[model samples]
Target: MTTTIRNGIMIAAMALALGACASKGAPTSQFDFGPLPAAAPASASSIGAIIVADVTGPAALDTERMHYRLLYSDARQSRPYAYNQWTSTPSQLLTQRIKASLAQAGVKVLSTTDAAASTTVLRMEVEDFAQNFDSATASSGVVRLRASVFRMHRLVDQKTFSRSVPAPSADAAGGARALADASDAVAADLLGWLAALPPSKE
Candidate 1:
């Protein structure tokens, strides 16, 4: 009977130690871009359909971590948060937002799996996506993307969009909010740019 009791106590103590270790190494918080606004109604001149290619970025922006820069320390240097991360890769999130925004605006957005005749295609490359800290208390979310419009495999137009939104705080949460706001602005501009182009011919 005494042996049995001693073994049970040891088992319980081991369990508690394991639980404490798990709690200490809990999973980090993850985030997404948040809700997107409803797309504006499609204009009569909107193209019939267009393909949105997956956005690509550098190794840093291509990751799921929330990245930031201490401009005061090194304007050209950046670092990622260890405990805060994005639910999806930054490029992936940006691509989803772009497609959703275009569709909401009444544009016919197509995926790579869709089959269609020669159609206009939009290619985007993310050059920069990070929070920049001018001071310990001040920061800004900066986003830069290069957009190219193609019609029936022919390049029609290309432009680069760069935006900086002031962050409410110098943290990941604030960066996320600022980035979301900048994304909306970029989407609106993309809508207008695509709408002005002539429809593609198969």
Candidate 2:
């Protein structure tokens, strides 16, 4: 009986030791929090006769400083995710991104200081820049953006674009992860649209 009790204790101790070694650290999902997605190519051809003014913003909503929340199944219930607020103006950052995308599309960006010299001004007015938590059960987040485009001082186009990006809704452990994912989605769509615009003439 004594021998059996001693062996039992020894086996228990060994099991505990093995469990400690096998323990994985905090539960972290293998999720990617990378830059935004890229936009599709625009159908418009390069208009060489016009000088494209770089994309300008603050034209709409200030998303950089906006706080984001995820609403699950019910509209009344929501989970607060990471804050999208930015110290800098959202328009300034957006303009820079737009300029880069235009450059990549072979568009010549006219100087902002020379507004009159620009053959056509690319004005983007942001309307709604906010993240909406549409469904909670599916672990999904939606980003909505409303913008207006101007050409020759006239409203040429206006529309709202919304994207449903995946969010990690496991728990608070993955709140930042989910928000980051949503943010990237928004940025990617915005860049893709900006990139598709036709370049101005040299």
Top-scoring candidate (lDDT): 1
For candidate 1, give the lDDT of residue 13: 44
Clashes of 1: 0
lDDT, candidates in the order shown = 0.78, 0.45
lDDT (tens digit, per residue) of candidate 1 on 1-202: 5999777756754543343234555678888889887665657255678888999889876778787777755678666676778999989999999888888877778876664743678899988888887766678888889999887677899989888899987677898888887877788888888888776665
Q: In lDDT terms, how accurate is model 1?
A: 0.78
| TM-score of each prediction | 0.82, 0.48
Summed backbone clashes in each candidate are 0, 11
Error of 2 at 30 (Å): 21
RMSD list, candidates in order: 12.9, 12.8
Candidate 2 per-residue C-alpha lDDT over 1-202 given as tens digits, one digit per residue, 9 for 90 to 100: 6999777756754543343234455332332233434545543245332334433334333333333333432344322223223434445544555455455445556655766665555555444333444432334444455555455676655566565655455333243355445544554554455445555433
